[model samples]
Target chain A: MTQQDRAHATREAILHAAAQEFDRLGYERTSLTAVLARAGLTKGAFYFHFPSKEAVADALVERQTELWAQVRESWRLRGVDPLSALHGMFAESADRMAADVVLRAGVRLNADREVGYPGVPSTHLMWEKLVATYVIEAAERGDLRPGVDPEAVARTLCSAALGSRLISSATTECADFPSRIREVLGHVLPCITAPAWELSGSQSASEPA
Target chain B: MTQQDRAHATREAILHAAAQEFDRLGYERTSLTAVLARAGLTKGAFYFHFPSKEAVADALVERQTELWAQVRESWRLRGVDPLSALHGMFAESADRMAADVVLRAGVRLNADREVGYPGVPSTHLMWEKLVATYVIEAAERGDLRPGVDPEAVARTLCSAALGSRLISSATTECADFPSRIREVLGHVLPCITAPAWELSGSQSASEPA
Candidate 1:
């Protein structure tokens, strides 16, 4: 590998190891030594990519945010309706949360306050904004019921989504996270959707992206 | 104070201090020494009431459960309808979360998995059952729309409530918790409740109980 490519590979490896540790041990208990051990990298290489454990965590949060943005952009490019796109986005994210250790760790780190991570609140606000933007589009496209406030609906759904994930993590290790989110959307969509518009299928979002 | 009354007060004091410390510092970081210092009791008095930090957390969880039960009973006694009673119960709990440090600490401790608290899962299950019971009663009384699954609806609402509280705690230290939960119910109730039974007022639940 070229020097640049090798450096890139090492950085990705460190991130992967950090995410796994955070997901498994949580942010407070996870140590740089443990992450180094998991990555099988020496201290010199580890410090070359990241300055501290918090820096690794911040990078993970940034990466998670980028992943979410990509999901939204992909759905938009596919000409999916705003409402369906929102559903699909959460479904896709939940899939990642279940299968991808880095994404799962990012989520856990964002939710944990004791870590003193600064990006957690902004991450939540970003999701809220993204959901609200879609809600507005859906409202304009005649997808939402009359008199539904896009911002309020967005906040409610955002809160519900947050709650479902936390509950799943606490109760079941999120084995059924996809279905749990589907259940939340099922209850919520009927209230927000225009009576005339039928949901193509409630299970569509849970399908692998 | 009599010996028994004085002992009871001391135990309560210790739990209160522990809750505050847990709420402020989270479960992993909160030290027993901090709790004792905050309670103004010596190590001897603290040990007299509790064996260890884990024991204090367990007692807090138990106390939180009792507080929830008390809210439900108070609403039931007042002849509130099941749907309204559920709203009132959550509202009252949120109020306590904002004003009562012990309850807030209990909630944070329960949510923190790194603490390795055993009662956490049971606490969530207990809430699910309580919500389901009320949802079943509401359905039986024709308050909820037909074909609503009590268990499913209960789970959804329970998850939503959990999410709202967590969000509020994280963002605003729960200053807006009452309104945040009210918003959750406002969106959810329309889906679950029969159209005939209007919520007396969305903000009514926020009123002092």
Candidate 2:
């Protein structure tokens, strides 16, 4: 393999290993040595990729942001309308968080008080901006109801999503998370969308949670 | 004052002093000695009320819950409809958290991982259950849209309320929290309520966020 490709592979291995450790043991308890062992890499190789466990956790957060950006791009490529793109994005994003260990670990670390770095823009705000971008696009497309404010809609949606996940983690079983998301979307959709607007394909945002 | 009245006053002073410290210095930085001084009470009196800083913080949480219950009871006495009571409860709760030092401290302490007691029920669940109770009342009053699930609406509202407050704290100015809450209520209201439903005299839920 090329030297550059080998370096990239090493970084990915460290991040994956770190994510698993962070998810299972939390940021406080996960150690560099355990991560290196999990990755089956030498200490030198691990050091070349990440300086510390904090750096490894930081990379996971950055990776989640990148994953979301890619999701937006894919929706654009699929020729979906802006409103439809949003419904699709929420569904896909929820599925990814549930199924992808690295992304889930990033989410957990984002909430970890010890691991959080103040002055950095919140990952929650980044997601809000992304959703706001789509809400603005939907407005430009004349898909929103009259007098609807895109920024307000975006803020509410972002908050609702976070609250749903937090509440679910606290009380409801994990399997019910998607249902909670659906309930939120179903109620919220009718408020902002023009009556004529519809979610793309067979999907319905108005479905009961 | 009666002996019971004097004892209750002492408890209130200790709680108030602890709330201000917890609000300003956070749960970790606040000290029992400081709280005693602020309350103008002896260690003996303080010990009669709370055993430790953790107990003081827990009392703050319990007080917030009690305050919300009183709000609900007040609404019932005013003969407000269930859905309208829900909106008023949100507005008043938001206002109280902003204006009342004790309530604000309770909120911050709830989010503090170092202070969290794992086995205790999340205060968020208590609010969710309270919201759900109103939703059921709304449905029985023939106020809900056909086929709308009261539980779903309740869950969405609770999550939305939480998400709005969290996001506002993370980025938006604190003053904007009410607007964020309004945006959420406006959107979610349309999906669950019968089209003829209204939010009581002079207060409209459909205001553009």
Candidate 3:
């Protein structure tokens, strides 16, 4: 590898170790020495890439943002219906949370205010904005019922997702996260979708007024 | 006052002080010495009632359960419709969380699993059970739409409330908790309530399917 490529690999290794340490012990209890040991790198090497623990956390948050943007772009390229695309994106994100320790750690750190990573967008707000964008498009296409406020439905969906994930993480350690997300969408979609466009049998299509 | 009454008062004072301390600094950072100073009690007096910090946290969770029960009973006595009663109870609870230090502290502690209070009922499960009871009654009375599942709706509502509260607490320090709750209920009620029994204009009543 070239000198620059080796530097990039070292930075990625440090981030991977930091994510595992943060996920296992939370931001408050995770130790720099332990992270360095887990990364199999000397303290000098660790500091060569990231100056501090908070800097690592900020980088993780930024990485999550980039990851989500890529997920959205991939879904957009598939050219699916807007609501279906929203559901697919959320389900895909939940699957990633179930499998990716780095994503889960980044989410946890972003939620923790004491971590002091200011200017990092909250996961909830980011999800809300994404959902709202899709809901607005769906509404323009008459997929949502009349008078359904896109912003309100989007906000509720985001909150339900957040709440379900939090409970699942606490109770089952997120082993059931994707199913919980399915349940949340199942409950919420019936309230917002137009009767003719209702997607799942779990929801009864609303009758005409 | 009798000696026993004075002792009870002192115990209450110590708990109140501890809740404030824990809320401000979280479970890991709170100092018992600061709690004693806030409560204006000697360390001997503080230890007389509660053996340790974990004991205080356990007591706080228990207290929150009792408080919620009383709120539910008071709403039941008022003889309102089940869905409206649930909304009232949640709104009242949010108001209390905004104005009451002990209740807010109890909620924060309950969410933090590292506090290690075994067998303590999670605030989410407790709310879900309470919401389910009301939803079941509403369904039996035909207030909910056909095919609506009380348990599922209740779980979603509870989760949404939790997510909204978490977001509110993080962004606005929960100063906007009640309104956020109002938004959650407004979005959720439309999906669950029967068309003929829809509650308010804030929610677009689901058209008959």
Query: Each candidate: fraction of true contacts kept?
Result: 0.37, 0.65, 0.43
* lDDT for position B186 in model 3: 73
Ranking 2 against 3 by DockQ, winner: 2
TM-score per prediction, in order, is 0.82, 0.79, 0.75
If both were scored by lDDT, which would come out higher, candidate 1 or candidate 2? 1
Among the numbered candidates, top DockQ falls to 2
- What is the per-residue lDDT of model 2 for residues B63-139, given as tens digits with 9 covering 90 to 100? 77688679778777768789988887787766666566788677767754321233456676676787899999999
Off by over 4 Å in 3: A1-21, A32-56, A79-82, A114-146, A196-209, B1-17, B33-52, B76-85, B114-130, B133-146, B197-209
Second chain TM-score per prediction?
0.83, 0.73, 0.80
Deviation from native of the Cα of residue A85 in model 2, angstroms = 0.9
| B118-200: candidate 3 lDDT, tens digit per residue | 24556667667878999999999999989888988887888888888777666656677777787778777877888877452
- What's the C-alpha lDDT at position A163 in model 1? 73
Please say which candidate is ahead in TM-score: 2 or 3: 2
Deviation (Å) of A54 in candidate 2: 0.8
Two-chain complex of model 3, DockQ on C-alpha atoms against the true structure: 0.36
Instruction: Write model 2 residue lDDT over A1-209, tens digit each, in one string.
Output: 99999999888888889988886556776888899899999988887877878999999988877887797787788787887878777766666665667886777677553212334577777777879999999999899999999988888888888878666654542235667877788889888999899888334333311
In terms of lDDT, the poorest run of 10 residues in model 2 chain B is B200-209
- Candidate 3 colliding pairs: A206-B209, A207-B208, A207-B209
Put down candidate 1 lDDT per residue, A145-207, tens digits, no spaces: 898889878877888877777666666666567777877777788888998766442336346
